[model samples]
Target: MNAEGKAGGFAPGVAKAEGALRALFPETPLQENDYLSKKTGARVFLKREDLTPVRSYKLRGAFNFFRKAIAGGATDGTFVCASAGNHAQGFAYVCRHFGRRGIVFMPVTTPQQKIDKTRIFGGDFVEIRLVGDFFDDCYRAAHVFAAESGGMMVPPFDHPDIIEGQATVALEIARQMHGESDARIGDSLVILPVGGGGLASGVTCYLRESGEPTEFAFAEPAGAASLQQALVEDRPVRLAQVDNFVDGAAVAEIGAEPFSHLQDFDARAVHLVPENRLCATMIEMLNIEGVVLEPAGALAIDALKNYAPETLRGRTVVAVVSGGNFDFERLPDVKERALRFEGLKKYFIFRFPQRPGALRDFLDLLGPEDDITRFEYLKKSARNFGSVLIGIETRNRANFDVLTQRFDKAGWAYQDITENDTIAGFII
Candidate 1:
């Protein structure tokens, strides 16, 4: 069946929401990228949602939510939301714009950059409270605060109004693609990053409802594959643990409301991007295109690597760049991760003899291209031997193979701890 036939009833509401959004900000540009196109053999276009006034498409939903709430005679004029990243900034911006008092509950672990930006956007109109270390913790706190304080809770996702707001991105995409002439929505592939599933569900539902024959793909952080797990279990389930490295998209659970819209999608349509690999994409975009992208912003672009050239060749592909609220303070960590993922850097723990020539013997085993980046004598495990922590960097990945071979031949007592998160976390 055609998309419009199945989702026709949903299209008009999305279109209406899109029309309302114009009063707030102009449509974000959809630019065709030569770099990505050349790499993937596709006519790659980036829907620059990162260029939104709040540096993410999140404000669209928040604005729509506030508009509907006010129109519905919500006289309290108070709003509450929980977010550790883009959603909090969007909610704060909307609250300020509407001149309504707002309370934002963010995780205590949220980056200072996000916290400061949220405060700046809201100004005196919003109050930010640091709750627990993860989003779910703050989310529960926000709910309790909303009920006790008689405030309307504006969820990051999982609400009809928020979904409608986010669907406006699809409306804009359709119109923009039509104007491009060479890009046809019917023949395009749209890649969206999934967090709580708001952006992905909204964009997919809208395009489907419009009866466009557009194909959809989703990108999710590998450490927080909530949407993928949901598809597998046939329901939303909270993860026992979540890695917040990709803090913007590190949702522990997919929202039930968003999952209802996304449940029918095939599991193959989703790509889980490794957190370290995502760092490489972020670095690539920054260095090559001079584009700054947050981890979540790079998710869709990074997922393009998972597609075979044959699948994307001759097709127009649209990947949403979700946000660019990256803090410069995190650059060192990003570069470190990128190097590790690219196999150009590694850490090792070595047991070295305390004799005079022991250090010289180890240094002699290194390849010409390999450079020592770190060396520290951890402790003397025995009277004649000491534990040494070493970090190495090389221009090529093959250098590590050669170096390891040399170590094995020389009978060096060393353990490669690069992949040991537990050990690395404690010392490296």
Candidate 2:
């Protein structure tokens, strides 16, 4: 039970865990974000976990896991773990920190940026093995490696030591918030992003234990609402499909160990953020505040949109900006998702009449502010009617409604394939 942590409040030895973390790095900042504060009419502070050594709070867990295992007489000094990007980098960082030999398993399809960062952090202390094409595959491979090699497997989020280590973020937040504000901790609200439930569980447990009566909100990826689903089913259930756009926070199944600390919460407290909407948040933060956040990092900020301005007015709220390992190469995709989510961009399939002036007639239906971004003939050889894929960008979402009406009036045979995943995947 000690390994899984106590059932109530702070996990056993979490205080010690926090103390151990101080040697690793200084506390990450809790800076007030004027942009978000004004937008929601709430005092918004961002816990800049994105500013950590590995650009994430993951190092805390990985370091503590290795420290505990080594201190507890599990010699041989070999450690292993599986991760997508952030966790691998964190584990590698911590391995180099302690000068310990480590093995990291990551997906073969993991971005080059992440792979290079992990290598940079580990230096000579860690070996990275690219296994399968997904996290699950790499995870299984890590387990098999540990089993055969008798190496200690450092779980990304499921172990008690990891949970305790993650709790250090809450400890820092408590101290930092109290120092920065004259108001009681109870007056403040804490919003956390949930992936495998490690960060949320640890922070919640620590807050409760430290006698903070603060309000709490959990932000989850809409495509992978593992924590929300677990609360409903009263147990962890594997998701049928998981969108990995917010790769850091996308987990098919919530961790069993972390779930123990979070299972009793009200489902309403968990907000599911759409992938596209999260991209909008990322873009907003980057363009406005000059903060380049990964999709998972933006989840907590995006969840603030779930609350009305009136409800949040005058409230002091904190959001954990979970990570900033975003690859700039994906900027175009992020922009596209953001545009689509805002309704400023759309894709449509039109069955144009086989006439010489058909395109001219169709172009005339577009509003003044509308611009055609893509127009490709799906069947150029057709005689009677040809199918064409068209992508339109507009100044306003309302313009689309007006354009749809015009299309109907013109008797154009078209399908709004913007939201059609199947057609968009193949055609767009």
Candidate 3:
């Protein structure tokens, strides 16, 4: 397809996206982040899509697709979309703006906050359908609904229109750099977080076409490295098992349309951010910079650790902060995971003597910095020995090393299962 045919607009997809998006809101900011720069020894810029009204870049594509669908005479039927988060919100907002009806299908497990927000946006113009327990199930239900109702289904990031629309982010990035572009963008390294590969493909293709000579790094959750898996096999491949911790960017497979533009990118360019480390980023950004990032939004920020200090020093770089749809209820879990990842916390099944002063003796070994977070007796083995679950937190990570050393010297029998997910998940 020609450029216009592929992107569904005359002025190029990015340009068309820019023109079409003005009706909704101004472009997201491209601001230099001082805190990251200080820590990385590089000039750090943030593509602040997280500050959007819908708190995501998903709105850009949703708006563009809605405009084109209407222009292409798709107004006769209600627009349908399958999404639980930002995409659903964007679609609902666009549907209302155009005075068109929309049908949104979400996983039944979707948080109430998202469902409430989507409903609020669509108002009388939309209908919410809780379909399946997973995304694929909801997607299938959405397609079925569209076919049965003669409505068009608006994809989250797989469609050409969506890619072209999402490419507008790069256009805004270019403008924000005062036209000098990213000579200082840290050797043209733009770290992007990938979900269905929409933003990465769109931005990379635009920058390359503009002859920006930039380098692209893609970060996906370790649980869902769709782009990496796709590049490894030379095609999009579905993952049998996925960890959905990074809910914003966890996809079983990269979208075929988005992957086409990204096919040439090396698989090595993709970085998988650990789910626990991502939790650390979320907590750090919130506490240090007042930036609230969801797991997917923290991807690019977490990738900063992958580069050497010399590689990024004095060079300007950009990390796309994707979304901020974080629920407050998850804060404790986030903190727990972050502490565990940072080695400030540990869990073990310690063998304890049921003799008198046994607990007192163990407490005497603990340093002033050591605090017991959890203590439980699992089984009554005998009068001499009993199984106990113990969690210890310390002010310094090294303190745990000292504490454990003392335990070994004293002939303490304990099994550290802190890093064992199977054991931790079941008990903790």
Candidate 4:
């Protein structure tokens, strides 16, 4: 059993991964991030695996797995796998590369944007099977197809070869950091986002075995801190609930193989980045730095706030930006979350009088920089008053204080529903 992170030994697979992956694609960039270095007081380098052909590092693992399968002289009848996003895309691309028939099983609910991209990448070489409404249905369908057709299922990250392939990211980082020499990279820290644990585990093991004293920090979306929970318990534990907002890095449980390599680490070191805060970082990168990062991809960048400047000063650090499978349709929500987290927006339910100029009175309270984005009348709660939903946006977060002060002076009865999840979920 290729236990998570190849507990018994993994150097073999990691060693071969470097060569096997080159045929599929070149090594992604290891960029010196001037913006991040200035922010964190560290010599920050970004292992830009997201710049791969598929815009994700998953291609390395997928290619390695396929190469190993064929190298072992396994019959290439059909290759089956279940995935809706990056994994499926990587699998399809690799299958096409090898001239092998590939069947990709994706949930029926997969975004059309993803489906179209996968089809475009694979062309006629791949056939996508839209299975049940959820992931379980898709997984079961893939397994059944594999069994009936004598095909092999390519797992996302649960295999030894996948782990080794994922480790190629680290290898590439090491190679890119040097000036085309046999000189090894000095001690550095690698900050990686943990989802299925494939990338984190593979990179960690490969660096350790390479005899590099690289410090490692694992980042997980707060809504899906599976690694953190598992480490604290000293056992692999499944989350009772998970938020799929950061779909790329939201896993209910870290892979068994990944757990083996990461089990010894302290739980505190596993930073849980708030999804909304990550959205803020995403917008900041897009607007200020022109870096487009998906929710999970921003995990490492968002986590920078947690580490003190002194802790990172003068040290070379690398962050693995995992994938960029962001669906733009979610951008509005992302923006709203970002605004809320950054304190630039707020929502309130106001009880205003039905008398004339009541609306003007409320409007008068808004500062010069404040803009009312949403205003709706729900119903009359009393003969003299009605309930209204109000959303306000401002250039400065402090504008809310002035707005609230005006409300208090004007005898306005209001409930702050910006953070009222029940109301926001139903109405907003």
Highest lDDT: which candidate? 1
Worst 10 residues of 2 by lDDT: 3-12
Candidate 2 lDDT tens digits, 337-397: 9999999999998988887998999999998999999999898546789888899999999
Model 1's lDDT to the true fold? 0.90
After superposition on all C-alphas, the RMSD of every candidate to the true structure, in Å, is 2.7, 2.0, 1.9, 2.5
Instruction: Summing lDDT over every window of 10 consecutive residues in candidate 3, give the lowest-scoring window.
Output: 1-10
Enumerate residue pairs that collide in model 4.
Answer: 4-256, 4-257, 5-257
- Predicted structure 3: lDDT: 0.88
lDDT of 4 by residue, 6-35 (tens): 564666666567876777677787778898
Clashes of each: 2, 0, 3, 3
Q: Model 1, stretches more than 4 Å misplaced? A: 1-8
Residue pairs with clashing backbones, model 3? 184-316, 185-316, 186-316
Candidate 1 residue 251 Cα shift, in angstroms, is 1.2
Candidate 1, residue 394: how far the Cα is off, in Å:
0.5
